[model samples]
Target: PPPPPPPPPPPPPPPPICQDVGYKVYRLVPKPSVQDKGGDTLELELPSPRSSILDTLTNMLCATCKPLDTPIECLIEDALYKADGEIYVLGRISEDDLIPFRSHKINLDGWADLHLQDFLNLGFHDKNKKDNLIVVY
Candidate 1:
């Protein structure tokens, strides 16, 4: 008989830190006249819900994936969320301890809950929340 196969290595441990999910929307914006380009210039639009570091990643990825008019179809590089303008990505709104979300891992359920409104709020609010503190008079 073949020597006993080594016990399957314990499943690789899960990541130490749970990464947060990031989302972005791509809009068709014309390039500035001042800038000279052969074809088109992919402009990076600020994501809503107050642009965060994570959101910027998505914007940059979509913008960089030029040649292709739409960047949403491109493979996700690093970490980012892609969506068409004015469309809210769908996901359930529920309270669960182990709910599936994507940042490092793609979770359909979590992605569904994302709404365009989330991106629309960008720049309107400070993500760092430093300004959120109310000063009591």
Candidate 2:
């Protein structure tokens, strides 16, 4: 009988390339202070309150219906100077609702202050010193 032909060589593997062709970046300038409603509310004390607030905003953005087909990359831009007792709630707020009230003390009060080390740990670099800003890409 004729000798069996040698088995064919295996096919070459695909090239080392990223699956994501491109990315759509979205920046969120979160409020420095988030309302502390008290009673078992998870309080995240961060060096940059804006970063924490960004998380809440990101979650809300994710929950909403897809506005675009392309994948989104949410970026957080941290800014200093806390807005005294500024509580950020999840949900849509009308323009009229944004009016400032005379009352200083509200149900949601308190600020999560983050420091240099904390920002570094969270993969944010100091974008500006004078303005006190940190950014995460």
Candidate 3:
């Protein structure tokens, strides 16, 4: 008898297009205060290069004042609220805690070390507090 036709090859796996998309995790540490609680961890998907994560974070933290352009100061201070109704600046993560976000552990050598200040510049013009801020990313 003639040999049966071989079964059709399995459909090609879906293109790995979405695999490139990834997320970044950030810790929002509010300035220390007697009436304030600890910080909050936020996970944000990598936005397009045209958009800024700082803007996204500002929008999430503050709904009232959304600046159209990058301001000269830390917006967190304007957004964060204390039990006493006072505004405070946000703290930056230590260099040790500042690491690049990777979906996998492979080829870590290629990833560069990223410092908190490198991404966000916290300007403390006054000795009493941090006033100006800029998002470098």
- lDDT minimum window of 10 residues, candidate 3: 102-111
Ranking 1 against 2 by lDDT, winner: 2
Ranking by TM-score: 2, 3, 1
User: For candidate 2, which ten residues in a row score worst on lDDT?
Assistant: 101-110
The model with the greater lDDT, 2 or 3, is: 2
Assess each prediction's global lDDT (C-alpha) against the native: 0.33, 0.35, 0.32
* Candidate 2 structure, TM-score to reference: 0.22
- Per-residue lDDT tens digits for candidate 3, residues 34-92, read 43233764443332332333444444333223333423334234222222122222333
Give lDDT tens digits, candidate 1, residues 35-116: 4344786544432332443344343333333222443532333222344321112232322311222222222212223443
- Which residue pairs show backbone clashes in model 1? 48-119, 48-122, 49-121, 49-122, 50-122, 88-116, 90-112, 90-113, 91-112, 91-113
| Winner on TM-score (1 vs 2) | 2
| lDDT tens per residue, model 2, 56-130 | 444333333222232433221332111233222322333243234212211111233223343334323334433
lDDT over C-alpha atoms for residue 35 of model 3: 34
Tell how far residue 104 is off in model 1, in angstroms: 25
Residue 52 shift from truth in candidate 1, angstroms = 0.3
